[model samples]
Target: MRHVDPAGTGRAGAQAQPDDHPLPTPGTLPDTSVTDPAVNHHVNPRTDDLAVNPGTDPAVNPGANPGMNPERSSGTNSGVGRAVNPALNPAVDPDMNEVVGRDDLLLVTLDTLRYDVAAELAAQGRLPNLARHLPGGVWERRHAPGSFTYASHQAMFAGFLPTPATPGPHPRLFAARFAGSESTAAGTWVFDTPDLVGGLAKAGYHTACIGGVGFFNRRGALGSVLPGLFAESHWEPGFGVTSPTSFEEQVRRAEQVVAALPAGRRLFLFVNVSALHQPNWFHLPGATKEAGDSRETHAAALEYVDRHIGRLFAAASARRRCFAVVCSDHGTAYGDDGFTGHRIGHEAVWTVPYAHFFLDHGEPTT
Candidate 1:
């Protein structure tokens, strides 16, 4: 319930003292060696037991692992609870066990990206790298759990990601045990812990947080709450919302971390891409601060992110397979109904873009 400023402004990088770690200039090459700075949804009325089609059930699927238990075969770390049944979860692929926990997990939050902007960018070919991994070659429209960074991300870490715009029990990809939860399907990876971060750690995955935006700057107790959940968390001056090259810096760090994680161990990497946040005019050529951030600038910011995100996907999937979730925490307002920012209820502030996909094992895609 911490109140966060929707407008990420001058003090966004408070934790990273400029004197100690100078922020990188827009055109400067990313400094991969920079030191660490600080630290779904659905509804439905169905019960836990579901009658999945036997023909499509992993228990009967020839491609499923023969020794894996269909009930517990969520393909997650051993510490997690068994999924009810993958057969009932359309989100869970029948061949999920073939890749699930066998690969690394990556979650990228495109902070404040609107569903319309992202969809348009993808359709216009401005987000080629990201579009390639989208489930249907486009971003899915969804409702954010919260209207602002802190609230939305809090729900997210606790397994309440954006729910599909559609109605009636959209099965979750992951969930924690709780009574009266109608969205937990057979394919949902039910974790015993209260939060997904802790759940993954218990399952023996190395969890890391590469933060962006003011909420993740760790400048105060409120900021520390989210990143503190991870085994390792990082933040830097260049990684905040104010930086024009934040996504580049973020991807560079992701490459370094992915390369350095312990061999043979799984990784749960979460990155909050700050480039899409406010003060994004820099992404537009010759655009001055006076332009005051608009949807056009927002799309440009996404294009900037797309230009470098492939390297991150490549790095994470280089050795083992990688499952990625890319979505915005929430959308922002650009004078829509006279609303200039988020934190208040509005269509522009509620609707977000979401997508999930897999990267197969191979050398990084250059």
Candidate 2:
């Protein structure tokens, strides 16, 4: 299920080119000491900025309640199988407007994850971190815009994320200013630029992209397009499909990126998690080298991903309240209907898991 390296190297774990621009030095970055919740009582300057903008309505800016009291969560928690109340906790609410413009944004594409597998793993307590954080403690079944990474991500950056399985004209969480967009609602953060990255940057966000799959590896012109949209982009062999610890490395890098941002700068962090894509047999317990990838290994990869993703959520939230969109770009076929992979129309390939939630400030970094 790995994409051929755009650099023509054919290696899934190709070395990435160095970033064109280096990150700011520690002294140049805004003081991030307010990450401590105890001293975070001061109002967020970004909230006031959005509020004063005549173009931004209060409904479009949800900074009024930047931090929702998780203690007020009506959901029951039993460690591995917790039920989250979307109404009480802004984090699990499907309403994107609840925290979008007001909070730092985190978009994580769980590459190649299928909806059925994600749901079943959460139910079985195999994806405990996700089960504990996802809205209603479940993955929302949706249809991917494209059957593969490159096409799907292109659409996502243009504000065409996976649509709900139920219907059309679904209000998008974010949108670019286009004349005939039916999905753009009153609450949608309509940006003047063509792509979300540019629009967010124009709106004062320090956009960053953490690459995982080949399309984002920056190995060639085609591979560089997506990541290039952001103000800062990063990739390497450890963050690619072949690495067993891709998600951990991505999270570690993400934490550093967040820590280095100016205190008042809003962050728009996008991470493409590649561990669940393919060559996932190693995630299974005592799996032999000859074992082929199957639905079993796919679920195991997701479980491994769930174990490490919590640190990412914690890091983003510790800096500021964050609105996160976590989902799969598309699913892969494991010999279903005689199909072995994606890029063709198939039930397994089109159906992916999706969810959006808030990360309250000062949450545990683990």
Best by TM-score: 1
Error of 2 at 29 (Å): 31
Quote the lDDT for 362 in model 2: 84
Taking all chains together, each candidate's TM-score versus the true structure is 0.77, 0.75
Q: Give the C-alpha miss distance for residue 302 in model 1, angstroms.
A: 0.4
For candidate 1, which ten residues in a row score worst on lDDT? 40-49
lDDT value for candidate 2? 0.71
- Encode model 1's per-residue lDDT on 242-276: one tens digit a residue: 99889888888777667755465577889999999
Q: Which stretches in model 2 have alpha-carbon errors above 4 Å? A: 1-101
Give lDDT per model, in order: 0.71, 0.71
Model 1, CA-based lDDT? 0.71
* Worst window of 10 by summed lDDT in candidate 2: 33-42
RMSD of 1: 12.7
